[model samples]
Every structure is written in C-alpha cells, then in structure tokens.
Target: MEARVEVSPEQEARRIAAVRRYDILDTPPDGAFDRIAALAARLFDVPVATVTIVDTDRVWFKAAYGLAGVTQVGRDPGLSTSAILTDGPLVVPDTLQDPLARDHTLVTGETRARFYAAAPIVTRDGHRLGTVDVMDTRPRRTTPEQAGALADLAALVMDELELRLTALRMLRVERELVVVEHAARERAERDRAEIAAYAATLQRTLLPPALPEVPGLEAACHYTTASVRDVGGDFYDVFPLGTGRWAFFLGDVSGRGAPAAALTSLIRYTLRSTALLQPDPCAVLRALNAALLSESADGSRFCTLIFGTLVPHPAGGFAITLTGGGHLPAYRLHPARRDGPSQALARAEPVSLPGGMLVGALRQADFTSRPVRLLPGQALFLYSDGLIEARTSRGARFGEESLAAHLTHHAATNRALGAAAIIDDLTVLLDSFAAGPADDVALLALSAATATPTTAPSGASGTAHTSLPLPARHSM
Candidate 1:
C-alpha cells in the first residue's frame, strides 16, 4: 500500500510541478502573503487559511494564519488538487458528494475533512504557481459573496508573487550599475546645495554695496531680512544722478522667505529700470504700482514705497522731494549741542506722509509728496520700522523718539560715523533684549546745508507743502 494518499498520481505531479517554478526555497515570510491568508479565513469563515505551495513529496505553506503550530501538512490533494490542475479557479461546494473524493484519505482519514475550496494562484506568465485555499472542518455551502471574496483574495496572492519576481529582476539590474546610482545621488545632492548657495549670494548682491556720497551731507542706512534662513522681500537704494543731484527709495513687499525674496529682486530691478526711464519721483512710483496691480492676478499684492529725488541748491545744500506711500516717516536731526548748555543751530521733525489706501486694493491710486532742504550741519534720516522698532534683549523697543534723539546727537557728525554709532549701540541693545530679531531693518540718512521751505515742484510754485494723501491700502 503506497500510503493511500487522496491525490492522484497526475494531480500530485502537477502540484509538485507548479511549486518548482517559483524557486522560493526557504524564504522568510512577508506581510502581503500573510494578509491574504487572513482575509481568506475571515471571508469564508474557515478555521484555517493557507497560501500553500504543493511540492514533489510534501505541501509547503508560505503563509498560514489561524492554524496552530503546524506550518503545513503533506496532505493528499485527491480532490483539493482540482484547483492546482486547472489553469482557472477551482471551487468545490461540497466534498461529501464528489465521486473522486468520497473515499479519499482526506474524507476517511483522521482529520475527516468534509469541505474544500481552493483558488489556483497563477503567476503573470500563465504558470500555476500554487493555491490560495481556505479549509473548513464542517461540510458547508458558499454564498455568491463568499465566492467573489475568495477569488479576490486569490488574485491578490498572484499579484504579490508577480511583484516579488519583478523586484528580483530589478535587483539584478541594479547590481549591474551600482556605481551609476552612487554618482547620481551625489550629483543630485550637490545641485540642491548649489541652488541654496546661489539664492544666498543673489540676496547679498541686491543690497547696496556702499551708501551714497553727497558732499557735505550726512547719511546712514541699514537693511535686514526678517527670515535669515531664506531670502527676503525688503530693499532700499541710494544713487547719485551724475550731477550734484541724487535719487533714492525704500520699500517693503509683502511676504517673507523665498517667494518674497523673488519679488524683492523683481522690485529692485524694476525700480532701477523705471528710475532711469522716468525720473519724476511721483510718476515712477505710480507707474510701478499700476503695473504691479494690473498684471497681477485678482489677489495680486502691492508694496509700500517712498520715492525721492534730490537736487543741489544754489546755496551749500541739497533739496529733497519725497513722494510718499504708507511708509514710516524719515526723522530730521539738528545739532544737539546743549550737552554743556550751548544752544544748537536748528530743530528736528519726523517726516509725515499722505494718508490714503494701500496700492493694489483699488483701480486708481494716488500718492502724496513732501519737500525739505538739508543744510550743512543738518541731517535727514530715512529708516524702515525694522530699525527704530528693533526689539532689545530687555524686551524694549528702539522707538522713534530714541531714534530722533540719536539723530540729533549725530547730525553734525559724519554720515558713516552716525550709522556706525547707531548700528553698534542697537546691536548690543538687541542682544540685551533677549534672543533674536523678529523683523528686518533698513535705513538711509542724508545730511546737507539748510535751505528755505518754499522749494516746491514746478507744477506748484506756491501751493501747500502736501500735494496728495498717503495710500493706506498698500497690501501685497
């Protein structure tokens, strides 16, 4: 008696033949296979679920959940082998009535199996690799739902096999070009690092390399990014117009970081282009605002800006015409020579701007202008809020009042010297305020001889000093 196995010689050979194709000998278990087995058990309500590989003399279980200790049984597949022999799925509703299985060892043996259903797990190459089957001790029937679920789970098993094979082939290809992958990864990282470096360099280049020079005029400035880790969208410019005249502007665009930095660069270049083409301070600012708003999307952003042109006066001084936006005012400083009770030659005033809306909120926008002349021993200070309002380590702010006083003390002194004193003192004070700066700072100061206040634009010989109102809605 040759062991009275339930499987026919043909079926056993087919099962063994199918298992040999995969060559997955002694492979460790994986989650995808285990999950399919578990789902089959749940769907069929079977006590045992298996992803089994039938081999030459024994049945090997790749994944078996819910069956205790025993990984596989060298069971005879007298009827169960129907799934393995067919290229398609094999479903046996009831094994008790089937002629081929009635006397098989599976039904008459110790296990006394009464029901069986198995799906042949085929590979993409049309080879039947194994069977994903669920087994129940009690003879039972299956609903259309249970049948469909079994088919679905079997398909998932086939997919996993296909994926594993493809991955194996890919691993072979990868081994052939190991050096290429290493080089590719290195090149990619280097490119990323270089891009970051370029952005930083571009940001530095946009800043004024040196402050402008106007004979007998005292000037100072500072510019900082609110986000040090990325590029910024804040800028200030000071340039001489070749004659005894000079032109300058300071502005803040909306946002911070890279996008803001990009816009910052655009605005810087645009201002330079517009300044050269159209020298009128008011026209250039208005044009820039209109161009920005018109070409932008519906939610386009705008900037707060101040444009100014300074021409030499016949006297030993320069006159400044400033067209205003929603920016903070420049502070004028006179000699604070009263440290020992001696009176100084002049007084100080904070430059006031027109009051209107921000640029992009409306279709038509207008800006105001103010004119003032700087004299010998007098200084005009232009600064963004980032400088005057710089937080100190003591949780205090270097406010407008303190800034005006500082200007008064340094007005009679050289422009570079005044800027150095302010930077040094402010830096130490900021360290005293606690941790770090919360915002960026920018400043520009000019000093020249004093002149009469009647120097208005040619369009208005005797009009009031303020020609227009400030635009309040300059949202980016």
Candidate 2:
C-alpha cells in the first residue's frame, strides 16, 4: 500500500510560470551547479544526485552527478514532483516501507530508488521552482544534519542562476554601445572629407587663373599649402592692368583655414579694384589698408604685402616700382658678364623697399615706394615669410642669410637657369630641408629676357618671350 500524493492545479500553474521566468529550460550544464550536485551526493551518501527544474510534464536536470547518462526523468506523481509542491525539505526514508513511495515508478523500475531526499528551490516571492535531490538504489534514511546541508546547496544553485542572468544582460548592453560608437566615427569621417573638398575649390578661386604675358619679361610662380583639409593664408597674382602696364602682388593673411580664405578673397578683389583706379604702388597699398581696417572692427585681421607695378623702359629693360607693407625684402639675381664667358659667377642682392606698418592696423597708414631696374639677364624673387621661417631636421630656422647663400650658389653653378628653373631648384631645396613643410609658401620670380632680338607674335607687344604651363597644386 502507498500513500496518495495530492495535486493542486492552481499552485502547480504558478510554479510552472515562475520556473519559465528564469528561462533556464534545456540549458547546458554549468560547473557551479554540477559542483553543488556532486557535493550534495557526497554529503548524503547517495548514488544519484541532481539539480532539477520541475516543468509542466517532466523534471529536467540542469546538472546531475552519479546518474549514468541520465539528464531527465518523468514527473508522473513521483517524489521529485512532490518536492516541488513543498515549501521545505521532503525526505523519504526507505521508499519500499514508506506509504508515499511504495508504488512509485522510481522505486519499482530499473532505477529502483528506495530512498529520496530533496530541498525545494524557492524564489524570494515564496514560489517553488525546482529541487536539489539525492536518491539511492538501496533502502536508506537521511540524518537531520544531512538534510540541512542539502537545503544550503539548493540555495547556492539559485545564486549561480542569478549571476548568469546578470552577465548575459551586461553583454547585451556592451554590444549595443559598440554599434553606436562605430556609426558615429563613420559620420565624422564623411563630414571632414566634404569640408576638405569645399575648401580646395574655394582656395583655387582666390588666385589668378594664369600669369599674364608681360612684354620683355619672363615670369613664374608657385604656391604650396600646408594642409588640404584647411585653406592657407598665402596668396599671389600677376595680371595685366591695361596700357602695357601690369600689377603683381604677393601677400599672407593673419590666419589659416576657412576664415582666412574668406578674408583672402576680399583682399585680392580689393587690391585689384584699388590698383586699377590709382595705378600707383603706394596709393594702391593705402587703399587696401583702409579697406582692411574698415572690415576688421575687432582688431583681429591684418595682412603683410608687397605690391608692384611694371612698365617697359625706353633705355633697356622694364622699370619696376615696389611698395612694401611690412613684407619680406625681394631679391634680384644678376647674371654674369654677357660679353665674357657664358657661365660667369652670378650675384644676388636684396632689393630693399621702404618698410611700413602692417596693413589694416591704422587709419592713416603710411606707404612708400622704391624704384628698381630689371635689366636683361636679371631676375627678381618675391616670397612669403614661410620660406625664411622653415625649420630643418635639427630644428634650426632657415634664416634669410642661408637663403641668400643658396641663391648665390645656384646662380654660380647654373648661369642659364631662368625664372622658372630658379623656382624649381628652390622648391627642391626646401623639400630636402624638412620631412614636410609646416607652413604655407608662395614664390614668384620675374626675369628680364636676354638681349637676343627675335620677332614678336602677331597682335602682341614687340617682345619675344616663352611661357610654361602652371604646375599642379601641392598639399602638405
């Protein structure tokens, strides 16, 4: 005879719902749960121990020890199912003698469990989810101390499940954060690329399209930007001002990037417009100074410039008048004797101009001009401060004295080098001086043609000269 086990549908439904909430069904075995089960079996001296969750129709083992190749067992009115219904430990001493276990399948079938002891796995809300159970093939009984240890092991299993759930939630949050950061980085890169493209186009518009053909002279110019992502402050132009006269200017604004580019465009147009109206070097600079001062109310903007005008001289070459507004002095490269050996030692001399205050600083700006002669076989070199301020690998500044020495050396070696060749050689030298230039450099060279008389082209001034196409822009 066996004692009947009562079943309550409402309580069983609530227990099943709480078990499902944990979402541990059909999960792989964990080392923590396995250790608990093994410890329970050893403490109770049983051959089978399992950490089981009681489901709707079966008892699933999350971890099992001493059960050979068994992961689950049916819950057809068995002792494990009865443990799920209890709030505390359920101990069956000698299942063959106890009325509740005498006819159970675990006792009569191949397992032949004669003893059973289980501690219910209960939630904080007082719902039973499963059991930590120990069983034996031979009839036995559980001591009071052994039952208490089994109950402690059941509590440990629940703690392990809570840790696993916390870890899974943290991993999900970390993955989502990684995805968002990657998207933000991509968007930033695209925005920088677009800004660079726009800056490049605007920089081109600020310079002249081409150097106009100056009669009785050879001209060449080069511009280098320190960065393509931001516009540079250096600018230059050589354009015809009408009536066989031409105006040329080279300047550097106070800063770099889009703000400087905007001001550069304004200065360029202002200079062109002012020069056409006055046609005098000093007068043109005064007009520019007034314009810049008017625009810079916050005292944040200014420019250093050298403006010049060229006209063919009746005596021999072109007569040049230059006005400086706190700008670097220009250099005149004189060739060796034309009647003597073709490669005589050449000379370089600084063409000094009257120094004035920086443009846009004062309302009554004072500007002065100096007259210079560019005879045949002579050239004038104008450059921005970037050339003299460039640094070498050893961190020493390449000052004006070093530049003068280099110019003298090149002229002594290459007597036939024209304005274009001089610019090319200087550019190569600058590149070799540093790994990369850290500032914007602008170079312009104008040379009077040699005394060889040749036929001029149709509809052109009676002067013979050759021109070369401009080189591509370089971005540091």
Candidate 3:
C-alpha cells in the first residue's frame, strides 16, 4: 500500500490566496526572474532551475533556465510542494531513492530527477508564495552555502514584486496631481483678467477728464502709467479757486495700486478745498499736511507735493507763489536769445522753495513759499521724480542734468515754447529714453499766452472755475 500524503486544508487555502495576490502565475518570463534562475542553475551545477509558483492543482514556472519547452508540472507531494507546505527550504538527494518522492512522476517518469532543492519565497506576513528551485538528473547533495544562496534568490524575487506594486501606486498618484494643478491654473487666470479690467476703469475716474484753461495762461498736462494692470500714485490738476486766482497742484503718493489711488484722490480734493478756504500757497500746504498726518496712523502712507496759487499781475505776467513739501524743484524755461550768427541759447532756472517735511508723516509740518514770475514766451515745468529717475538702455539715469539739457534744447529750438509744446516734446523724449518706464510720471506745464485771446480761460475750455464743496471731516 502507498503511504498516505498529509494535507492541511485551512493552511493550503491561505497559502494559495497569498500566491494569487502576487498575480505572478502563468505570466510571461521576465528578465529579472529569468536571470536569477539562470544564476541558480550555474551556481548549483544543475541542468534545470526555475522560479515556480504553486497553484491549486499544478505548479507554474514564472521563469525557467536550462529546461525543455515545459511551462508547468503536476504539484506532487514532493520537494517543491514540501517547501511551499512547510514554508521552509527542502532538499532531496536521489529523489527516486527518497520516500517523499518515491511515487512522484519526476522520479518515476522519463524526466527522472534524482536531486532537488528549493527555498520558499516568503512574504513579510509569513506567507510562503513560491519557490526558487534547482533540479538535476544525477543524484547530488547540497552544501550549506548553496542552500543559503537559493533562499537569498527567493527573497530577491519577492522584492521585485513589491517594487512593481509600489511603482503602480506612485504612477496613479502623479496622474491625479496633474489634473488638480491644471484646474487651479485656469481659475487663477480668469481672476487676473477681471482684476485688470476693474483697475483700468478706476484709474480713469481719478484723473481730470481734461486740463482746465487758466485765464491769460496756457496749460497742459500728461500722465503715463507704468502698467495697465495697476493704478499709479502720481496725480495732477489745474482748477480755479475764485476771485481771478487759480490753484494747481501735482503730487506723488508713496505706493502703487488701489491704496495709492485712494490717497491720490484724497490729496487732490483736499488741496482744492483748502486752496479755496485759504488761497495762500503756504497756508494751503500746511492744512494738507495736517489732514495727511491725521489719516496716516499706520505711517506707511505719505506724499511729496508742490501746491501753488496763480494771481494775475497788473503787469503782463502772472505772479506765481509755490510751496514745496519734499518735492523736486520746478524749472522755469526762458526764451531763446541769439548767441551768434547761427546759434541760439536758452536757460533753465530752478525755482527753489524752502525744504519742508513730506505730507502725511508728521504731527506738525512746516511749509514755505517762493514767489516767481511766469512771463509770455517762457514756460514753467512741474514733474514727478519718475521723469528724472528713468534709465537709458545702457543703464544711465536721466538725472537732473539730463532733464535740464532737454529743457534748454527745446527752449532754444522753439523760442516761444508754449505749455502744449513743452509737454509734447518731453513725452517724446521720455519714450525714446526708456522703452518701458519704471514708475508713474505726472507732468504739468504752464505758460503765459503770447497772443491775447477773446475768451477768458474757463471750465468750457477744459478748465473748471466753479466753487467745489468742502471735504467732509473724518476721524483718523
């Protein structure tokens, strides 16, 4: 009678489940597994080596070396199956002579394997999934070193399965992240476009629709914003105060965007109201300084301003008194004089005011006025720091010296340089010097009319002479 083969149904069920979890049965030969199997055959001096996964009724070869065209064999209660069942290494020398393999086909059939050794491919959870096994037709015994090598090779096969699972998980996560990033970028682009449009509209409302015409005077103004997406801090306006007197102010706030724009509007309206109440250039500036200081509790906001009162003189010219609050000095361009037979020359005189503290910065601010005469055929130019701070392509600054040279050249060429002509020439010069301006530029040019006009300068001619409402007082 044949010896009965023992089997444990519960343990066998779990072992089969672990083998299926790897999904390695009946798969095409992989280079990694094939290479290890070939190395095993060479190391053990065997005719055949295989990476075998035991199934329910048969054993499947994932990788085979030195074997004929066979992919699978019956799972007899033999060496390879014993390695899987016991979850350990098994070695049988002369399988035909061994009781464990006496009735096995591998020993009784044509492919009579006399020797067999195998190591279990165990998972971290102690589940034996498969085996790395070597077989030979002649009887042989395995050294302890050879047995350990077979066990090491089996562990390496399990590592390859773990790596494949990890790579697949990472690939899935990367794909999901790409989808999320694309959606976020699209939403941000839409928001940016809407913000740019709103900023442009707000910028237009803050500036004068057109420059006001002053009686007996010709005035022009220009504003260049550094970017269309953001509002600038620079502002300028020319409006009548009352009683044959006119007020004009130009200033630059501390920063850019909506906050700076709000401050610009406040400064502009405050100057108009204060000029009407006091009319004195120094007094008007003092009132503005007080208002600014009260408003800027955080101390981050301030401005440099040049405020002036234009009174018609009994003589031909206008008596202009101006107060400066940490602003650049104004320039008076004189008419050209014939120097020689061919050359003509002109001069740019600096109209300097006593230095005062910046508006919106101090509890108490000091301001002073200097009286100047603006005659016919001569022009007065007021500009923000942006004009002088511009840079050339070669990184040279268009400083005070360069500005003075430009003014002198234009005055010499056009002996009677009007306000309009000065603004036009300066705009061209700035554009040529810098392809893109680094900051906002505000320019205001005033000149006495050379020829007497029939109509008095009024709001109809882009100049406003109406009394403006006083700004409402607010708690800082």
Pairs of residues at least 3 apart in sequence or in different chains that clash in candidate 2: 3-99
lDDT of 1: 0.59
Model 3's alpha-carbon lDDT is 0.74
In model 1, what lDDT does residue 380 have?
A: 66
**Model 2 TM-score, all chains together:** 0.56
- Model 3, span 158-233: residue lDDT tens: 7666654544444455446545655757877555544545555556556776776666677888887766567788
Top candidate (TM-score): 2
lDDT per residue (tens digit) for residues 384-409 in model 2 = 98888888767889889998988887
The lowest-lDDT stretch of 10 consecutive residues in candidate 3 is: 467-476
Instruction: List the candidate 1 regions with Cα displacement exceeding 4 Å.
Output: 1-199, 297-299, 337-342, 345-348, 405-432, 449-476
lDDT value, residue 334 of candidate 1: 65
- Winner on TM-score between 1 and 2 is 2
| Worst-scoring 10-residue span by lDDT in model 1 | 460-469
